[model samples]
Target: MKTRQFFASLAAASILLAVPAFAADSAQAFVDKAAIGGKFEVDSSQIALGKVQDQSIKDFAQMMIRDHGAANAKLATVAGEQKLKVPSALDAQHQGDLDKLKNAQAPIDPAYVDMQRKAHADAVKLFETYASGGDNAGLKTFAQQTVDTLKTHQQMIEKIAAGQDAITGATTPAVKTDNTPNAAALVPGANSFTEAQAKSRIEGAGYTNVSKLTKDDQGIWRGHATKAGEGLAVGLDYQGNVVAASK
Candidate 1:
């Protein structure tokens, strides 16, 4: 009688364990969703960065590539370990998001840091939901850990996007100094200027002996200037903006 009771209790315990396992099958769904999200992030990041002209936006793109790619790898390893089957591609919802992102309509400006911030926000929310609600113990733990990381990334994106926004509204107008020469020959759409024309413009602006003009890689022209310790180069753009005045 004692042996039969022991065996019955053991069987009940085994059944209890099996119940959670069945529930954990739902983890496969979250895993698939994460994989799809990660892929869309990486793809959209690279493609949008290509169209972006802002330096800050370019830096954000690099971060997305690094963070999202790492997350995908970790998820892939976990999927392999658990024998979870992930989708080869995103599902309808994720695919729709990807299409919107590719078209720059989802984030409103694919190259902008705000776009990345919003995307990361969405990703963080998704991760949080799954991590907290996932059925599988392993995936639940993984999701919890990912939520922390995603929150950190979300903060970074927010900070950067905020900085970018500040830059938009906070540009200081260039102060015209007596020493700054007017060289209207380097603006993007400016007409060609001969050495004589450039020298005339420079000399007319209280500059002396503004000769020996050289062109930089971006087709901007520069003249030589002697500062405190050494001879410096003064790069002037087509609109005569002083791009760089350094040695």
Candidate 2:
């Protein structure tokens, strides 16, 4: 009777141990999927850099590359500490998306913008779920922090999509013909410029009241500026192009 009781107690302890192990396995699965998603965003955006002709689309793609690349690096470090393995390649679904982007025969800007909208929407959902109740404590915190950035990206992409739709419907050329040089050409390799340096460059270009300077996910410096007493929204792209849109 004593031996039988002892064996029963040991089996109960073993089951108790198995429970946490199962939870850890679940956490590992989330980590893997999250990592893959980040990689997909970075890779797809890189492809857009070469294929997109629209400056706005290119700017959006640059932001994806910068933001996703940073997030992926942080995630890799977190996963490493927990002994979870992250896959370097995209899964089948993401690969399919990439293929479509590469082979798109339609105007590339709309196609790319549409894809970004869908992708970010799904990403926001995924991060929200994991952040709210995932088993991994460390990764849960990471997810919560990252959800804000994901939402921001979503909002930006939505605006881009709407603007692109309007541009597509218009009959006139997107920009009037002028002798002005491309603003992007002025600062070659502008991505390397610090925020202060970028601000100086904007000021040098005859913009005043430069305030609310913030770097968006695409490594662009955006803020409010005034040229001849008119308020304007302006952005400096990674390649040093100063793009201004009238308010």
* lDDT leader: 2
- Expressed as tens digits, the lDDT of each residue in 129-233 for candidate 2 is 989988888889989989999999998888666545533333121222453322342233336556775676566455788888887665667787787776766
Whole-model Cα lDDT per candidate? 0.61, 0.74
- Candidate 2 has a TM-score of 0.64
- Candidate 2, clashing residue pairs? 63-217, 63-218, 184-241
Candidate 1 lDDT (Cα, 0 to 1): 0.61
Who wins the TM-score comparison?
A: 2
The TM-score values for the models, in the order shown, are 0.54, 0.64
Q: After superposition, how far is residue 132 of candidate 1 from its true place, in Å?
A: 4.6
Query: How close is each model in CA RMSD to the real structure?
Result: 12.5, 11.0
